[model samples]
Target: MICIMLVVAVVTTPGTSMASVKMEPLARTAPPPVEFKIQGSFDPSNSYLDQGTATISDNGNQTVKISVITEAKSSVASIGGTVYLQKWTGTQWINVGSASTISASNDWYFSGEVVKPAEQGYYFRARVVHWINHNGVYEQGETTSDSRLVS
Candidate 1:
C-alpha cells in the first residue's frame, strides 16, 4: 500500500514567502525532544533570548499564511524589540520583513504574520531581538527559529 501526507509548517513575514509541503509514504521515527531552559543558567541582570518558531500554511486562493514567534527572558518595563523574518540566501541571512513589540511582562512573547507572495518560495525563519532599557542599561539579545522549506 502507498500513502501520502500533506504538511503545512513554518512562518513568514511581509515581502516574504512561506511554502507548504507534500510527502509520500510515512516513516516510523522518534520525535526530537523539546528544550525550554537556556544552555546555561539564565541571569536576571543579563539579556537572554529563546529561538522561537515559525510556521506557514496554505490559505487557499493561491495564497499562503506566514506566522513567526519569538521569545525573550526579560520582562523589564517598556520593553521593545524587533521580529525579523529572514531567508537563507545561499551564504547569509537576509531580512524579508520586520515588526516591533512592546511589553511589560517578564517573559516576552511576540507573534507576527503576513501573506505570502504569489510566486517565489524560499526557506524562511524568524529572528527576534530585545533592544531596550533593561534595568537602567540598554541590553539586547537575539535568536533565530528553525529553518523550514516552503514550496
Candidate 2:
C-alpha cells in the first residue's frame, strides 16, 4: 500500500502579494498496494507488484490526464508487463485507446491524456500483466488496480 503525506505551510508578509506558491513533497512512501493481487501462475521471483498507481487530472477542453506507475520489488524493473488504461462505463469496464507495453527495465512509468466528457464523473483504472520469463515455459501474472473517480 503506497502511503503519501503532503504538508505545505505558507507564510505571507503583511504587505506582500503572493502570485504563486511552490510546495515540494514532504514525505512519500511507496509500499505495495493492497489491491494488487497475483495469480498462482506467476513466478515468485516477479510476483510482487509494487508502486501501482493511477490518477486523472483536468486540463480543460475536456482533456483528462491518466498516469500509471508499475514497479516491482525494488525501484528497478523486475518484471515485464502490459499496462492498460481502462474506463468504467455505467455497467462495465471498457478499454481505452491507450495501451503501454512495459518492458523489463528499471521502474516503468506511463502517462497519457484522453478527451473525455467534461464535468461527468467516471471511473478509471489500470490493468497490468506481468509476463514471466521468455523461456519455453512462460506464465502470465495479472493484477488490476482500485478504481478512481474522475469528474
Residue 125, candidate 1: alpha-carbon lDDT: 54
* lDDT score at residue 138, model 1, on the 0-100 scale: 62
What is the lDDT of every predicted structure here? 0.50, 0.49
Runs off by more than 4 Å, candidate 1: 1-75, 102-120, 131-135
- Of candidate 1, the 10-residue stretch with the lowest lDDT total is 23-32
lDDT of 2 by residue, 25-111 (tens): 221222223444443234455544433444455544334554434445543433455667666665566777666664554443423
Native-referenced Cα lDDT, model 1: 0.50
- Predicted candidate 1 versus true structure: per-residue lDDT over 29-73, tens digit per residue: 222233363422223565644334445554434344656554566
lDDT of 1 at 34: 35
Candidate 2 TM-score to native: 0.43
Clashes (candidate 2): 2
* TM-score for each of the candidates: 0.44, 0.43
Which portions of model 2 miss their true places by more than 4 Å? 1-78, 105-120
Q: Superposing all C-alpha atoms, what RMSD in Å does each candidate have to the true structure?
A: 12.1, 12.8
